[model samples]
Each structure stands twice: as structure tokens, then as C-alpha cells.
Target: MRKLPNLFKFDEISDGDNDFKQVMVSILKKEFPIEKQSFFDAFESEKYKECAEVVHKLKHKIHLLGLEEGYILSANFENQLVNNSFELYEDFVIILETIENFLKNI
Candidate 1:
């Protein structure tokens, strides 16, 4: 079986010259939360309006960043939330955590 590589390996969120980790760090610094905690906390409330908005903005940026996988994952999250599908909360949380962890490195 062929294993797929992590799709967030490269992007244009920051200067193209910078590598993956650097670009992620740059994005985080520019964004509200440079770490995972704030990112998670944004979705930890009933007023998930901000979360949805961020997802939308990030979804657009992800394409420019060339991170279709993350964009797709985030879109699913937004979709489920918008449609009141919280049954997969735990599973989504795992995916979100994985995204945050991946951002911690390249």
C-alpha cells in the first residue's frame, strides 16, 4: 500500500522562501494564537461564530498556502458545526489536535 505524505508540507502563507515550520510559525504569530491552546479554546464555547469565521478565512488562505488537506478538514468541522452535527466532536477534536501538532513541526 502507498502511504500518502502529510499534505501541509508546503504553502504560501508566508514568504515562499521560508520552509514549512517557519511558515507555520509566521502564520501563528500573525494569527491570534501562536499555539494550539488558543486555537482549541476558540471552539470551546457556545458562541462558535468566531470559530466559523476563522475557519472560513483560513479555508481561503489554505489554498493560497496550498494546504488542501487542512482546508478540507477545517471545512468539515465548519460544515458539521453549521449543520449542528456534533456527534463527531471527539473525532474532530482528534483531527484538530493532529493539525495543531503538525504545525508545531514541519
Candidate 2:
């Protein structure tokens, strides 16, 4: 399998402390699933506002993961959700999948 791009900013996180890194990883591990489930539930139920809320919450995790471009895309995706636009759904899903895969490796 192809190696994924680095999804973290180690040097910037906790000043490169290993304990801090572990804490960060643990936090992401715990929170990602909840955020993802919320997103899926809202999306499946056609609750655009709820979806937007979840996306907004996930956006902070995206930035913490050092996915700068994904962060920008997620902001757009959140707005699209608020507007009930499906135009960017596919792209947003791709980003989510990438993050999920990356999280697994970490």
C-alpha cells in the first residue's frame, strides 16, 4: 500500500514532546469516531443543520491533524451542508476517508 502523507504537525504539537504526541493521538482516536458517527447520522437523516454542526466540530480535528488543505475544504463542506448542497459531497467524503485511514495508522 502507498504510504499516506503525514497527517500531524509533530513539531508544532506540544513542542514535539512524545507524551504530548501520545495524548493528542489518544484524543483523536477517541473523538474521531463520535464526530464521524454524528456526521453520518445527520447526513443519512437529511438533517443538514445537524450535519453542518458536526462538520464544524470535525473541522477543529482536521486542523489539529495538520490537514491544512482538508481544513479549507472542510470549511467549504460545512457551508455546503448548511446550504443543503450535494455538489461537494463526494470530495468531502474522500477527505473523510483519507483522514480515517490516516488515523488508523497513527
Candidate 3:
């Protein structure tokens, strides 16, 4: 697994409301895997536009997780997918996996 960056934007945004934080985390834990699988399926099928759409959805989660740089990369990758490019695919996958591992441990 890649190194998890020290991210707490979600914590800051939740305003110390543990209940609200838990709800948001729960939503992410449930939704992320489904979006990830959709991304993989679209990628495997060579549906670049569809892949872009999934990335679009996932990028919001990236931002919510306090990954400012990752969010920018995701936005760029989303655009690349729309243009049928795979140049940043590996880097983007690393971000996804990092988030996956973080969510699992949380």
C-alpha cells in the first residue's frame, strides 16, 4: 500500500460533530467501492467517457478526504479519460488504493 498522507479536511469540516463525521465516513465506505468497480469495468470495456464519469464522481470524495493534490490529479485524469488517454492511469490508481486502504483502517 502507498503511504497515506496526513489528511483531516473531513475532520475539520465536520466541526467536531462525531455523529456527522461517522455518517459521512459511512457513506464514503459504502460508495467508494461501487464507484471503483464501475471505473474498472468502464476502463476494461474501453469506455473512456464512462470512465470519466466515474472519475468525476470519485473526485468529490478525493476532495472530501483532504487530498488537494490528489483531487487535482483526479480532475486531470478525468479529462484525460474523456480524451481516451491512459497516461496517468497508474498514478490515479495509486490514489484510489490509498484511499481504499485508509477507509478500511478507519
- TM-score order, best first, reads 3, 2, 1
State in Å the error of residue 57, model 3: 0.8
TM-score for each of the candidates: 0.52, 0.87, 0.91
Query: Considering only N, C-alpha and C atoms within 3 Å, which residue pairs clash in candidate 1?
Result: none
RMSD of each: 4.7, 2.5, 2.0
Give candidate 2 regions above 4 Å deviation: 1-7
lDDT of 2 by residue, 32-60 (tens): 88889889999999999999999999888
TM match of model 2 to true structure: 0.87
What is the C-alpha lDDT profile of model 3 across 1-106, one tens digit per residue? Answer: 3336443876887899989888888999999999999999999999999999999999999988878788999999999998988888999999999889888888
Top TM-score hit: 3
Model 2 alpha-carbon miss at residue 42, Å: 0.3
| lDDT by residue (tens digit), candidate 1, 19-101 | 76565656654662332344456677654666666656655544444455656766887777676565545654555455555
Instruction: Choose 2 or 3, whichever is better by lDDT.
Output: 3
